[model samples]
Target: MLVSIRVAAEELGVRPETLRRWESQGKIEAPERTPGGKRRYDLAKLRHLAPHKAPSERVTILYARVSTNGQRDDLVRQRALLETFSSANGWPYEVIEDVGSGLNYHKRGLKQLIAQICSGRVGRLVLSHKDRLLRFGSELVFSLCEHFGVEVVIINASENSTFEEDLASDVIEIVTVFSARLYGSRSHKNKQVMDRLREVAKEVSP
Candidate 1:
């Protein structure tokens, strides 16, 4: 069926100007023109432009996360920041919020995000910070996204939080868990281990 330039751009996930440029560069066949000089596109021919899915059908996802409920305010701020950033870019988007340790891979939001990506339902994944996705193995998820043709956008390329800070935090959480498991949650040895880890963390963290 014949469609207008605007509709073609929407279906192809590009601007009408991009279509014009492609035509000029001989990248795509020229569009039909009405007597009034309006460009008309044939949807049948343009399906090749978006081989995976119609770009309009794949949503832009803004993901936000915090390590704990204590950081609920930070999670809220992350959501707001992501919303503002995507809105500024004129992206049609949805925000997914998660509250869990970055070491946790079983977070509901994270699972949902991965599921959507695998299903080819997501066009883009936007994050306020890379660590917000996962402290460890985030690269694996990124690889999955790349395989699925999902674009990953990190809002802040350079982290405001240092690796040492994150490492210390992760160490403390790990020690807390293992100490409890080995020495029992209420055991004095567990307390001592946690205390010692805190002291070492303080020494190493900036």
Candidate 2:
């Protein structure tokens, strides 16, 4: 299962330079070279990258995430549950865990998992919940998985009980920020108003 560099690059939907960049960045295992020094990629590896197989026939990825270090134990629990799920299904699995805000896209573990997904080696992905994977626009990622023929299984697909609480937090944070700005903008007028009220109160003898 050996292929010339051009064929391999074409199959990967990347330019040859991209493949060379992948090698340089340690994003992929280096391809072997021929005696005359031509690059060759193992076709098996390339095939594994995006095998057109049914869901049950492919390797799985278990992704676990927590918003902050405070939820490290929750992250562990997520991994544990995913591991159990993967085991029951009898699929070879890898767990990718991250401790960062779901709103963030730059987490190291998240980036690595995406790269793996892009390589097409992952057949399916299992997550405890949707927001555990991201706080917003999770559908974009799901669409990417669909485009790549990767299945996404959210163990809990229903509305989360704490969704309102989380949403409230975001709303409150926004309100508090703007409330401060609203006051700060009229500090001079507000001070004058307060002084007048105090003077009237004194005139009325409390």
Candidate 3:
């Protein structure tokens, strides 16, 4: 059966505000309201909506990424930290490593992690930091986790900030715009050089 908002909050071990924020962000579906406008949540839905419990039998998945080739060892460090963290917490976990620019989320290791989450094989996703897992933004990752009912734990931040506050779409949009402009300028320069080459070729041919 569904529970009330207050009960859900208690069960989830999060503030009502957090739940409200998740709803606002579309990270999770909004709860159904009663005649009096009180929110109601089903037990199954509550389990799905709630964050992964700190101590649970479910397996936790760790994702670590390094931006450059020099940072390959950094991936190892991240894996170590995740292992230590999980061991210290007595949580059974596995490590998945990806070495690449955080600018793209389509890395092979990331794809495997997402697939596992989508398949409900993972209960929680642990990351070293927002930038490590999401230099692009959190929305895409957040939405993916929310859709699959997986909990996310960013180990770097003790408190949330603007990076944590804004929607993922906004962050990704900014990155996309910057990338487009950079490529567009380069394309323009290349086109100009090609045009000059064509003119020189025509004059020489005559």
> Which candidate achieves the best lDDT against the true structure?
1
Q: Give the runs in model 2 whose Cα sits over 4 Å from its true position.
A: 1-57, 159-163, 169-206
* TM-score for each model: 0.68, 0.55, 0.57
> What's the lDDT for candidate 1?
0.81
Report residue 17 deviation for candidate 2 (angstroms).
37
- Model 1 pairs whose backbones collide: none
Using TM-score as the measure, name the better of candidate 1 and candidate 2: 1
Worst 10 residues of 2 by lDDT: 171-180
What tens-digit string does per-residue lDDT give for candidate 1 at 1-206?
Answer: 99999788656655466679889999889989999999999989987877533355689999999876888999888999999999999889988899877777999999999999899889888999888898889988977876666667788966677778888877866665565466765888667867798689778878
Model 2 scores what on Cα lDDT?
0.72
Give the total clashing residue pairs for model 3: 1
Model 2 C-alpha lDDT per residue in residues 1-206, reported as the tens digit of each score:
78987787556544466568778998779989899999999967766554333345556889999866778888888899999988997878988999876667888988887887788777788899887777776777876675576777778876555655666544433443344455676787755655555454445431
lDDT of each: 0.81, 0.72, 0.68
CA lDDT for candidate 3: 0.68
lDDT of 2 at 19: 64
- lDDT for 10 (candidate 2): 50
- Local lDDT at 82 for model 2: 92
Model 1 alpha-carbon drift over 4 Å, by segment: 1-54, 160-163, 176-184
**Ranking 2 against 3 by lDDT, winner:** 2
